[model samples]
Target chain A: GQQVMQIPQYQHVQEGEDFTTYCNSSTTLSNIQWYKQRPGGHPVFLIQLVKSGEVKKQKRLTFQFGEAKKNSSLHITATQTTDVGTYFCASVTSGTYKYIFGTGTRLKVLA
Target chain B: SAVISQKPSRDICQRGTSLTIQCQVDSQVTMMFWYRQQPGQSLTLIATANQGSEATYESGFVIDKFPISRPNLTFSTLTVSNMSPEDSSIYLCSVYGSTPVGNEQFFGPGTRLTVL
Candidate 1:
């Protein structure tokens, strides 16, 4: 069985603050993906990391993949009200196209 | 990237009733999937919907409870049969677009089911 876990199940922050969510997998993964779901919205793909020690960024958001490919992180700088949502991390395990998602980190930003 | 649409944005059903959710993709896709998002929880995969063949379900899921039909490459349906209160959740349809860049899955708006 494959399992993906995330930490800081919930976080409350003020505008202009920073936030980070960590994702870990029980087994090695072929690729890792990040998604964000706003209140009452569908899960939207944010980014994907494949190679070990990989780093990618979009605007103020940064994503990193662990050297072992079993962990990943998503960091947001100067968070805004628009950043309020549940961030989920998913890992594609070996021999399957399916993805196992973490419990997710819910971010709450106060203006 | 592809645009996805689902029918019956939300529904209220009595216990033991069933609901069939429809999923349509703008572009043809190879693999389609069904997932459940429980209240305040992560998404759990139900099964992979394949065209012209029976769906391959995941552990803890069965075709008896969640029957799926993929009649074409761009269309699919997931029927939650004889659902209970535990089945009251958001059922989503998703797919990975055919592309050479990478595998990126796009999700539908989801059908919110509330069983009483």
Candidate 2:
């Protein structure tokens, strides 16, 4: 009975604008992962955060894991049209390998 | 990480018909997961299949509706039985790949199903 909720279910931003999505879980998680699914494409693994309060970055993207491990966030700087997609946060249930995916945030970057 | 391929990239089926989707992994994995994504929706786990063992389905999912077969470590199948319009969705297969940080899931090019 675990649930992962994400804020700003949908976002539209102009090119070069910054965007961020927040994810909150009802239960504690061992680790959290971020994935991006492009239009007409499958989900692609972007990054994973394990340690509490950890932050990782890749180019224009930044990911952070809350200190309690029950929340996470993904931020994109200077967004581009290529950044348009649905971003999802997933976490493995404690003692289980199954992943619980968040509600997902759909991003649309306008040129 | 892991390369996964799925059969029948897209299909249009009539109600009450069944469609079997195949998932093939380039390497052996301990578990393969099936997920359903409705239009503009998030991924919902359908089941987890383990080689040589019965699959473990998630809540609201039943084996009678979505039967799964894991004949080997690198291959699996999911059959959507008695399909309906509401059953139209994208079915994705995923497997975990080991990473220095943690396990990350790699998804195949999902099978898009449209039931009429």
Candidate 3:
């Protein structure tokens, strides 16, 4: 079975500090997607990386996919209280479109 | 991404009882899925609901306990039969295949189930 391992299960940071979460898969993935879930809310899709060694950014958030397509990272610069939530990374297996989600990294931003 | 709506946003049920959660998508989709999110835990996939076919459950889930119904392309139901305290969790229904890019699942608000 394929598995995705997320580092730093929980993180707490000051309002202006930086935070980073990593996702590594047991095998190469077809694509990787990132999501953010607010406390007591469902996950919302943020971005997807399909190409190897690709990078995408939104506002102060940067997303990157490893050259092997088996690892990914999300980094936020100068976090805010509104950034508080759990971040998840999902990737499809070699043959299926069904996405397998990581354990998730819960981020807490204090003002 | 697809827009999904799940019914019975929250419920309280007794042990041994059964709970059926409904998921309706705004538009037709190829695949639908059910998930469980325990308090402060990550999303765990329960099954994949396919239109006009039986659902495929994950490793830890079984069809006898969690039966799924996909009567149409836009509507699906997940019945949690014979519940227990461990069944208490937020049940979410999601859909994929509205966008042209790779399949990215979009979830509904979720049905919060509490079994006592």
Candidate 4:
């Protein structure tokens, strides 16, 4: 069975502080995607990383893929109250299209 | 990105009752998926809706409990049959869309089910 795990189940940061969440897959993944879900909202697509050792950035946020494609990380610089939400990493294995999501990292930024 | 919408943004049902949630996509898509998210928990995939074919369910999920209907590429339905209090959660539908970098998924607002 495939399983995805995330570290630091919950995180609390002061406004303007930096935050990072890690995701790991029990098995190698073909691709990984990041999503953000605001309180009382649906999961929104943030980014997708396909290549191993890939890094993508969105303004104050940075995303990276492990060389083995079994792990990923998302870092948000200068967090704000607007950044409050749960961050999730989803991955699908090769030869299959089903997505398995990690436990997720709940972020709370105190304004 | 595709626009996705779900019916009944929220609902309250009695235990042992069933509820059918509808998912509609603005455009045709090849892949549509159902997911459940409990309060303070991460998303758990329920099944993949195959157009004009039987849906492919994930482990811990069965066709009898969560029957799915893929009438077309743009529409699908997921019925939670004989649901219990444990079944109360946010049900979401997502679709895979083409992107310049690669395929991405877009999710609907989701239906909040509360079983009493």
lDDT of 1 by residue, A1-111 (tens): 888999999999999999999998878888899999999999999988889999999999999999999899999999999999999998775798888789999999999
Tens digits of per-residue lDDT, candidate 3, A20-63, equal 99999979988899999999899998889999999999999999
Model 3, position B30, has a per-residue lDDT of: 74
Question: How do the residues B55-94 of candidate 3 rate in per-residue lDDT, one tens digit apiece?
Answer: 9998999999999999998999999999999999999999
Q: Per-residue lDDT tens digits of candidate 4, residues A63-89? A: 999999899999999999999999999
TM per candidate comes to 0.97, 0.98, 0.96, 0.97
Question: Which 10-residue window in model 3 chain A sums to the lowest lDDT?
Answer: A91-100
Would you list the C-alpha lDDT of every candidate in the order shown?
0.93, 0.96, 0.91, 0.93
RMSD of each: 1.1, 0.8, 1.2, 1.0
lDDT of 3: 0.91
Clashing pairs in model 3, backbone N/Cα/C closer than 3 A: none
| DockQ by candidate, in order | 0.78, 0.87, 0.76, 0.84
TM-score of 2: 0.98
Which ten residues in a row are the worst by lDDT in model 2 chain B?
A: B96-105
Shift in Å, residue A21, candidate 3: 0.4
Off by over 4 Å in 2: none
For model 4, the docking class works out as: high
Please say which candidate is ahead in lDDT: 2 or 3: 2
Winner by DockQ between candidate 4 and candidate 1: 4
Q: State the weakest 10-residue window (summed lDDT) of model 3 chain B.
A: B96-105
C-alpha RMSD between model 2 and the true structure: 0.8
